[model samples]
Target: MKLLLLLLAPAIMFASERTVTMKVSGNCGSCKKRIVKAAEAVDGVKDAAWDKKTKVFTAVFDDGKTDSASIAAAIVKVGHDVEASKAPDAAYTKLPDCCQYRDRTHD
Candidate 1:
């Protein structure tokens, strides 16, 4: 019984469902695809979606391997606006002229 329970413990401890939402600014299907794809690209991200106009992004992933802020950062990496998160200089600089957030603070 002890051996059997020990084997099952790891699987039970590993079971988890992590989902979160974020704010991002945009206005088109192309933007949606880009933002969602960025978030989903992270390891352990099971899914991602966004409303381009509202900038709300939803993501489902495994918490043991990932977290919300990192996911949000990834979306910003591909040239989308995350509400309170800033994209890295290299990532932000790569944005299309129009996609750029135009905020000095983001630097």
Candidate 2:
């Protein structure tokens, strides 16, 4: 029981780590790679995944070290649009043709 308690203690203490999923506009495999890379670039982000069809990005991070807003900002910085944040015009314009998502959203 003592050994089990020791193992469980770490899990309990780190329970604040969480995963958040939100809409992120994108169109293809390249978008997925870019989105995930942007998300994981944020400090404390443990993992990130983006779904092209759903236009959703999911990220796991230690809440003690980072928050959803910070992660979203990182994605925006890399030219991806998150639900609450928009990528910069210059960065968005620099994306490859297949990665351009603004026109598709308008359509």
Candidate 3:
């Protein structure tokens, strides 16, 4: 029993923490707010941060309850484009002019 408990401890700890960083298209502070809020809304997501200049979003979540894909989907739902997922056209169009990262004219 002692050996079993010790062997499972590491696995349990590993399953509790997961961090992922991926590209998220966003141009300004409002975009950053939406992206981070979307990620944090997902179950098991402990924290999320997005950098406008780098277009990178980092998320920390519990592997046992959620994965990177779920977090990405949540962000997409909020009209941000993640590396593996893109927001729907309708959703993207609803973003404010300043938050339209896909529009090169604004850049």
lDDT of 2: 0.88
Q: Could you list the CA RMSD of all candidates, in the order they appear?
A: 4.7, 4.7, 3.6
Q: List the residue pairs that clash in candidate 2.
A: none
Q: In candidate 1, what are the lDDT values of residues 1-107, reduced to their tens digit?
A: 99999998987798687999878866566667778788889998998888655567899998877888889878877876688866677876776655555542121
Model 2 clash tally, residue pairs? 0
Judging by lDDT, tell me the better candidate of 1 and 3.
3
What are the runs in model 1 whose C-alpha is more than 4 Å off? 1-8, 11-14, 101-107
| Positional deviation of residue 43's Cα in model 2 after best superposition, in angstroms | 1.5
Q: Candidate 3 on 1-107: residue-level lDDT in tens?
A: 99999998987877878899999998888888898988998999999999877888899999988999999999998888888888999999999999887865244
RMSD of 1: 4.7
* Residue pairs in collision within model 3: none
> What TM-score would each prediction reach against the true structure?
0.73, 0.81, 0.83
> Between candidates 2 and 3, which one is better according to TM-score?
3
CA-RMSD of model 2: 4.7
